[model samples]
Each structure stands twice: as C-alpha cells, then as structure tokens.
Target: MADYSQSPLELLLANQQKGYVGIHVEQGVPVLDRDLNLLQDLISATVRAVISRYVGNGAAAGANGFAVQALPTGQNGQDFLIAAGDAGGPGSALVGGVEVVIPAAVTYRSQPGLPALTAPTAAQPDPRTDTVYLDVSLAEVDGTVDAELNNSRDVGVQTSVRLKPVWVVRVSEGDAVPAPPSGHSFYPLASLLRPRGVATLEAAMIGDLRQRRLTVSDMERRMSLMERTLLLPAFTAPAPGQPQFVPKSGVIGQPITLNGSNFAVAPVTVRFGDLPAKIVGGASSTQVVARVPGGLTPGGVSAAVRITVSNLGGAVISDDTFTADPAPAFAEPTTQFSPGNGTPGTQVTLNGFNFNAAGTQVRFAAVAATVVGVPTATRMVVQVPAGLVPAGSTNADVKITVTNPAGSIVSDDPFRAELNIPAPTFATTPPQFFPKSGVAGQQPIILNGNNFNFAPVTVKFETFTAVIIGTPSATQISVRVPAGMTPPGTTKDLKLSVTTAGGTATSTDIFTING
Candidate 1:
C-alpha cells in the first residue's frame, strides 16, 4: 500500500475516546499492529493540532532560528546554512494522520527534500519555494543479543523499532504552497533562478521558512503521492525455501519452474490469477514444473497475476507475484530484399511475416544495419551502414539477421553490397590517348575518362612519374612527363592514374612518350 487512508487512524482514536485503556488483540499480528498505530496517532494528532505553534523564543529573532540561508546569487548546491538559532517548534506533525517528528531543527541541510532540489531555468525564473516541517518516522534498529547463551540471550542480533526525528522540507515551484506531495517531496532553502541562461538569486526572492507566518489551513487539503512512490518495506526480506518460479517473468504460455512442498504425493493444481496452468510430468515433493496459463489479458500496462498452489493437504498462495506478458511473436526469415546491391546508405526493405512489432534489429553480415522505424509484423526497412564492402571489389554477399526479444531470423540467401566505385576509363582518339604522343618532360598530354574521384591524378611514362598540370576533373585531365625524363628510357609507354578511398582507377589508354 502506498499510504494508509485515515479510516484506520480515526478508528483507533474513536476507540480510545470511548473507555478502552488499550485496543483489544484478536488477530495476532494485525491486532497488535493496530494497538501500536492507535497510540502513535494519538501522539501525532496532539502534536500537530495543539503544539504545532512555535514554543521557544517567540520573538521574531528566535522565530527565524531554522531559516535556511545561502548565497544571494544562484548556484547548484546541496549545502545551505542555519544560524546559531535560539528557538524550536513542535517536535512532530501529523500528515495524513501519520505522525512525523523531528529531532533536530527543520532545515534543508539534515533533511533535504525527498526528491532533492531542482535547478532553475530561464523560462521559469522563480526560485524553488519550500516550507519546512518537523517529521518523525519509525526506523528498525538491530542490536546483538549475545550475553550468555543460556541466561541473557535467546537468539542472534534482534531488531527493535525506534522513532527517528529529522527535518523535512516540502517543495513547491510556485510562490504559494498548493499541497504537500507524498513520497516525492523537495525544496530549496534559497531560490535559484536562471534568466537569460545566467543564474540570478536574491535574498528577498527566497521563501521565508520561518520568522514569517503563513496560513496552514489554506493549503491543508490532502495531496496524492509523487511520480515516485516512497516504499516502507513490510520491513521483511524474502528467505530461501519459499515458493519461487525459475523464470519470474515472460509472455503468456511460457514455462515456469515452480518449487514448493508436497507435490509428488498427490496431484497438485496451480493457477495464475483465475486461469489454470498445466503441470508437466515428473513432479517432486518440493518441485512442480508448470507453464503460465494462456489467454490472460495483457493490456498497455501488462497483467499482474497471483500464483495459487493447492494440494490434497491444503492450499497455499504464493508470496511472489508473476507478471503476465502479452502475445509473443518470433520473427520469420525474409528471402526478398529490394535493390540488394548498392553503395552504403541504400535503404533495403525486407518482406516477411511475424516480424517483431518493436525492438526489431537488422544486421547485414557482421556489420549491423540501421532500422528505419518501428517494424511491422510483415515489413521492415533498414539503411545499409557505411563501409559494407570495399570499392573496386566484386559484389559481396552478406547474411541478413533480423531479431527481437522473442527470437532471431537469419536468411539463407545474403544481401549483396556492390560499391559504386568503378575502374577509371579514358577518352580515346580511335584507341589511344587524346594526344597520342608527347615528349618526356615538355609536351602536354590529355587523358580523360570516368571515375576520376581522386585528386592529383599521376601520369606515368615507363618507370618515371609525370607532373600533373592544374586540377583533374572527373572526366578530363592534362599532364606533362616527369621533370627528369631524358631522351633515353623516358620515351616508352606506361599506365597512368590515381588511387583513393574509392579505389584505384587506372586509365586504360596508354600514352606514348617521345624523345
């Protein structure tokens, strides 16, 4: 339960207003718990309603004792200041009938807001407004009970409940207090405001936690719990040999290994919520294998189910609860993909049945591909990630793996990646270069073709490097023979071109060198 409603507290008070010295004990645990609660509430309500007003140093000087302080300029921080104060207020206050007391002064230092303080922003320049309140809660304390095994001690370390007092500050974004938020309470002792991206805070902008009186009944209406629910564990922990399921969570009709007492002696029955589950063969006294019942409705939030175990001797309800998942679908292999071969960034669509509705991933070979959006049951689109295949290579075939939480589907046929980079070609006069012939170092030769994606296209004559002139366009280029080319060996033909990230493109047309 997130919080207790007031009916339980009111019942306790009404019993005492009558003539009972103490509450009656009927149901062992619950009755004793009720008596403790009644006394606790009486003390809480008395503190909140009667002694709630400040007691010590009623003068404004002492009234501001617990007033929190910080730099006038805004800054991110957890530390704040409390002056050597002279006064104190009620030690406890009742919140929704639960009494909270404070052992120290109510300040943001010792007891910061439950959710902690939030930074300010430009759009909202107001500092975080907060009110300080005394809170007293019960904490379980443990002490070793080892004195003498027979005389003073009964067990190992034993646990006892004790009241803990601390300061609690309720936070509000607005200047005025609306209502207190349960579980998620926060506050700022000093207002931290951000306007135009620069934080600006001033002393007058801060909320007067004390020394300034504010109306309480005005905002006394009960408030709901915050986004996060504050939990007080039944103050218990799970022990071994308790009923447990192997797989604690899964889709409907999934198998669960349930282990408990006395299952082999007689036919045992297991139920998830109201649906009966099938108990597999080979049952043991302490173990029973079963499957989560099918047909339970799992909606947007999923379904919560309780497992009930029954046998010839008696029926026992499981302390652990199982969450029922919605229908499950295993993705199926896709044989057909569109435009299977191309450069990276080409989007491929896979056609298949029963593709996972969400969290579906597509991988081409070892490299993972990008999924376009949420995949439907029959269709999925993905973009090939960069560098699937090297340029100038033959078409590469890569297996496609589509998967989700349910399962994976790998295609027998592979997706093909053929990089768009092609080998260089040349503009030919009949069958040779445009110029046909040139001197080793002085003549200009023009070679033009396609796939000239690289810069500084180098032209060669035999074993010598030619000097390229200006820039080389994708389809045209002009070059001169190497500077040292002499009348001897420089007068022979050789291949000319350039290599780049797109691959080496060598011109097919050979240039004739002249002496």
Candidate 2:
C-alpha cells in the first residue's frame, strides 16, 4: 500500500521503477511485471481508470481494486526481448521479469469495543488531512475483528460495499446561510454533497453484513436528530426604561433613532402608518436611524400612526404610536387683485400648498378674515372682514397669514388694505342749476358740484334725462335738459342729481322748470 500521507512528488519518487517507466513492487510475487512496455501500459491504464471513476461517478472510488492482465507473447516466444545495441548501448542486458500475482480477497468487520449506535462526541483536528474528525470507535476491517478469524481458511467469495456517510452541520443563526422552510431546522450542505440513487444488492448478505447496515443507519439518524435541535434566533421587545425612539415626536422629515434588540444586521424598512419612511444612514442589530415620513397628522388633533420595522426575520410594530407634529408651508397667492387693495366685503382668492381645508383661516395682520366657504388644501376664497384696518385710514400694510392645526405661515410680502369710499354727498352749499325756470331744449342748464372728476358721470333732473354738453370738471358740469321734461310752457318742480364712481348725490333743494 502507498503512504498517501506523503506529498505527491515524494510519493511518486518513492514508487518510481528502476530502469523502467512505471512503479514496481517487491512481494512474495511481484505485484507489477518488469517488462518495460507492459509496465508503462499498465500504469497508464490505472491512471485513466481512476480519472474515469472520479468524473463519471462524481467522487473518488473507495475500497476498490483494479486488475491488469499479462500481455501474450508472439509466436517466436521472444517478442518482448530487445537485442544488444538496439538502443542506448551495446552492453545492455535483458532483465529477467517476475510473474504478477493477485492478492486474496478480504472482508471488512467491526472490531470489539466499537461505539454502539451513538454519535461521535470527541472532535480532534488531523493536520495531515487538514480536517476535523470525531473520535468514537476503533474499527478494524478486513475480517480481522476476532483472533480466531486471523488464521481461518478462505471460504466463500468476499463481497464489498461502499459506505457513503452524509453529514449535517449546525451553524449560528447569524451565519450567512439560507433559512430552511418553516417548521424545519436543517439545511443540506450544498457544497459537499448532492442527491443520488442507491443500488440494491442482488444477492442476500450474511448476518454480519446485515448488522453492519443497521448500525450505520442508527448512527445517521442520531446525527440528524442533533442537527434538528439547533437553536433558532429569538426576538424580544426592549425592557422597561429603554428608549424606543430618540426624541419620539418631531415634524416630518426629521431624523429619529429606533432602538431595539434582535434586529437583523441587514437593510430594514420603516413605515409610518401605511407610508414608507426614508431610512437615514444604516441599520444595525440594535439601532436604526430613520426619517419621519411625510403626511403624518399631528397627534391629539389627529389619530396617531403606527410605526413598524421589517427585516428578513419578520416585522415588528412599536407598541407606542409615533406622534408627528404638523408642519405648514405656504406659496404665493394666484391672481393679483386690481388696484392691489381692498376693504371689508372684498372677495379675495388665495392659492398655496399645505392648507388645511377644515381648520384653515386667513388673517390680515392680527385680524382674521371670513373664509367664503370650505377651503381646499391648495386654494381658498376669503372676504376681507370688517375692522381689518382703522375706519379713517386710507390704507394699511399688513402681513397675510394662513393658519392651520399643523402650524401657521405668513406671506413673505405684505398686502395693502384701502379704505372704502362712502356714498357721494352734496357739498354743504349745494351748487345751483342756472335758469331755474326754463323751457326744455330752449335753454341748457349748468350745474356745479364737488367730487365729480370720476369718469362715466351721469346727471338726472327728476324723471327727465340730461345730456352733458362737454367734458365734466371736478366741480362743474354743463347739461341740456331733455325736451320731454314737460309741455313747452308747462311749469314743474324737478330734483337734480349727479352720479359718479363714488355713488349718487342728489340736490336737496328743488328747481322749478318753466315750459
């Protein structure tokens, strides 16, 4: 037998044939013939067979032997003989060859004191093999288990069977291994072995062979049980007085830390209610820093939202709900009101984002405006409420504020509020109409007043209309009385009035018209 413990180069040199191209062995009878050509062919065939077994069977064959038949000689009975001086030298001599002999078949047997039906418990490192082995039993095979069998005569043909043991290893839950299916605890060692079919023996085996098979099965079952009992990872909520989230309450987009145990050292997802929050930095087994998700309502004012963390193991929800405070933001209003000023009763339109439809209010300086109707989140219509500014003030510059339960935001610029003009009034000493008693169209009347510079002014005399003769001044206007005022010589009393953008003003004193 070759000493496999030696290095490949050393082993090859130790088995090298002398003056031949193959390995040679010395025994009672030679294990390899000395014929150079035959020896070379035998070595080549053996190597090829071993390689084929490894490739075709997916593993190296254990406890197997190869047979090499001797080559037949030619008719001259000197076919393998070489003549002197044929090659190398003329002094070369023919070397006598030994006949090869096959060794007797042997059977493996379990030695006495071998471990019974129990998994090996002692682990020892074998540096020569670079592997860890379990020391359990000392088994001697080759039918030498009993002293009486050492000298026993050869009997029936020995049958051999290969033993392929499957190994199951347990690792910590933190190890990078695919999780087994639910309710199971073991995963196959994918790098070491694969499933294959087993062939049945054609002939019946003796009592010893049957007992050996049972023993192997018992050991395999016990090893499987040990693997199945491996500890599974566990998770528990933080103990009392431990912080769950640092500074628990905050506005949206604020970063907060979540502290817990048994968190997988992998990517974890955080959710605020049904919305996913942005994770800041990274997550570890005990701490994760995350940002508060937007769209969460303020606590007390609105229902609190549940916070959850999910990882490979499973998902865990915080017992206490996360309280998100309201954050309000405002944008510029849409349309520019004509004159950029208004008083009480003026309808104003506001456009912006993040406005609360139900509890939103618009304020001018410190005074609140009357919302026309239910406001939308992005738009609202409000009326400038009374007392927004002092009664006599011409205009007031004040900040426009939008308030909601979340918070309040003020416009970057101020809005101007102008005083409303009262109805037009006649001067204390009212202007008189010239030609108090004049026939219609026969004469034109001239009226004088104050505050009449506004365009589109009109003048009326009782029920009769008048036409302005020319452009009206701030204090005076000329008009021709309508011919229909009355009959040509009829007399009647008529009230004169003037109208402008401010409003209408009538003359308290009446004038008598002559027909």
Candidate with top TM-score is 2
Clashes of 2: 2
lDDT per residue as tens, model 1, 13-69: 576578444444466454445466666655554554343342211112223434545
lDDT of each: 0.53, 0.50
**Where's the lowest-lDDT run of ten residues in candidate 2?**
201-210
- Global fold similarity of model 2 (TM-score): 0.28
For candidate 2, write residues 1-515 as lDDT tens digits: 12123333333334453333464555686443224334444464455444334322111112111110111323211011111121223211100111111132211112234222111123411111111111111112333333343344555432221211221222121123444432122321111110122111111110110011112344454567545333211223556677577766776567987877645444468888888988887676777778876556522244467678876445678876677766544443434222246877888776555455357777888888888876554566778776666753456777778877777777765678765655555556644667666667644677777766565688888867788888877777888877777676578897889887678889877778777
Q: Candidate 2 overall Cα lDDT vs. reference?
A: 0.50
Best by lDDT: 1
